[model samples]
Target: MNFKPIPNKFEYLNWQEIECVAKNKRSTVIWPFGAVEQHGPHLPLATDSIFVDEIISEVFKLFSADIPLKKLPTQYIGFSPEHKGFAGTISLSSNLITSMIKEVGSQLSEMGFKRLILINGHGGQISLLNTAARELRSVAPGMAVFPCFLWSGVNGLSELLTKTEIEDGLHASLAETSLMLALKPELVGDDRPNEGNKVEIPKGWSLEGNAPTAWLTDDFSKSGVIGDSRGANESLGKNLKELLINHWSELIMNLMQSDWPNNS
Candidate 1:
């Protein structure tokens, strides 16, 4: 059961069709930003992409079936290269990813889709997305570019997870592993690694590494895992998914109703 919905129309859709659908249906054009990063030994390299697509599909289905929210088509843009050191990790430079997103947002704005939401599945692309949003706003002032980091977007759900030492929740952790098991159980392996070694964090050190300095994903985890993935379960994934959908839906609706800054 492949989860992609846009299918063949990904690269060939014309502005007319996109505009028509968005305007008539009040649909919000969604662009899922994912990375081809390693997910430990159990999960696949495409875990982030797969999980993101599944979550969006589930939310779209819920909207189409029950909620009156307009259904929007989503496209996947894989731009992962930071995990290249690890097996099966493919990444793109920050410049390329940022440029691609800006181009997409600009085109969508031209198509009359003022509301563009970036559904980010990978943490590596967070700053890039922010940069792209700012640039897009500069070009298309009327357009509303909202980049939703799905993990951070889910409010209060992180506190529910048992693991507290997991910083940034990189690679495969309780959150991601649980999401995979829930969304695509067939892909997860049963082997569990013993937990004893933890990522050494210097005294008063933060994700930014040195004082007010930024760090990459590789600087965070050695095995590419932040939190404890040994206790991941399907129940937690489902709960997290529900929470994210509700939260994002509310935010999107609010954005739709609000006024767009002339230089936004």
Candidate 2:
């Protein structure tokens, strides 16, 4: 907001200050997109939002000294039609989410912010987000709209998150639980027996990665957990948080003023 990029909270700044910064095209805006959906029995429904919020906070803290980046308020509800059967899961239509993202991006771009990044935590809406990003390409013309998952953007995430978990896991899995353990210990309740321990994931039932197909959470899991959370620990969570922060801080700082990569 101050444009000084030091000891300043962007969210606290007034519209005049924000406009001044935006006019300069000197800062990047990061919007965290997540969902208010069920995260099994142990984790809060706001798991995705909370995780992204913490990651964005740390990324900013890690980058504040070196870069001009503004953190926008998070979008707490997202596309989660797959989790419909689960109680308390508020799923916005894919169309709604994409349209909203496009609107936000266009508004920010018109304000003269040359770069807009969507740091998404929820996986269900990723495809739609890509569409939103592409839509902004036309609407915003010269602005760079990037939609990405924090873990996927990390350098060595495959080493940290196994292919099995990344592929088969959907909710309340090892990765999400471990992250919650690190960031919000109190919110992570006891790992009830069989939670995330369903031996058979079944055919046509998966959330992310190279899967044969996708299915609803209630189609297979009774506990709403797709993998074992027993193995999660605070240490792993801490390590992951540090790794993510370091990786994003470095990558984002270097790319602040550079052109977007050739890859989509």
Candidate 3:
């Protein structure tokens, strides 16, 4: 096969297409950040990437009318420091993630792009991401870089959180499993997860509760799962995607019109 790159729009845009976008549009690039960490036996290690891909696609679809944004291939390996005990977990160092984002943003800035956005799907790397965003703005102040998490601004997850108990409702729990089921059913391996060698956290333990504790996944859950995945279904996942699309569409529309400091 004569490969000429993944010839398409967004992630695979050719230089010529990029030039066109640069000249005619308030150009932005969306990078999907994820992790290659364990997500119980039911979900694949690449689950985060799959979720992010959908997020990137939906953002472009919903917000294209407001601004033209190109999607980049998902950064498949992220900072998963908390998951080090897992066999397949591939975590990057904070310095590396931070430096990589800045370097990429600087290059994009040189390419005449005005904005760079990272739509991260993994919560394990939030600290690194926060640092990356700050460093990008400080080092390349001329380019507007926004680091956003897929789960942070979802209104649809509100009720889900209340019912599912978000404190432990993360990881390979109901919400994440439901999303995986909706997006890629074939890869749902076996939704019936059995607790592995993990030591379960306290019944009422909360990740967000005001507890002065420092622990990782192995210290808490027996399997990689933290919340109940008993009720995960396609409908729940579909609803989340819809709400996320709406939320991101509105967010990008505002970002596109924001009084960006670097906008000329």
Instruction: Determine the C-alpha RMSD for candidate 3 after optimal superposition of all C-alphas.
Output: 3.5
Q: What tens digits encode model 3's per-residue C-alpha lDDT throughout 115-219? A: 888888898776678788989888777777888888886776777555544655668877788888888988886655533223344775545455424557777
Runs off by more than 4 Å, candidate 3? 1-11, 63-67, 194-206, 209-212
> Which runs in model 2 stand beyond 4 Å of their true positions?
1-10, 192-207, 257-264
In terms of TM-score, the best-performing candidate is 2
Best by lDDT: 2
**Model 2 per-residue lDDT tens digits across residues 1-264:** 535433335676678877877765456788888899998989999999998888878877655443556888888988888888989999988777777878888888778777888888987777888888998788887678788886676766577777766665567888889889999999999964244435465676544536745667787788888777777889888888888888877777777766453222
C-alpha-based local distance difference test score of model 1? 0.65
C-alpha lDDT (0 to 100) for residue 228 of candidate 1: 68
> lDDT per model, in order?
0.65, 0.77, 0.75
Clash pairs (backbone) in predicted model 1: 80-90, 80-91, 81-90, 81-91
Weakest 10 consecutive residues, lDDT, candidate 2?
A: 192-201
The residue pairs in collision within model 2 are: 196-227
**What does candidate 1's lDDT look like per residue over 165-212, in tens digits?**
344455587777887887889999885442323546577875533553
- lDDT value for model 2: 0.77
TM-score of 3: 0.86
Model 1 TM-score is: 0.79
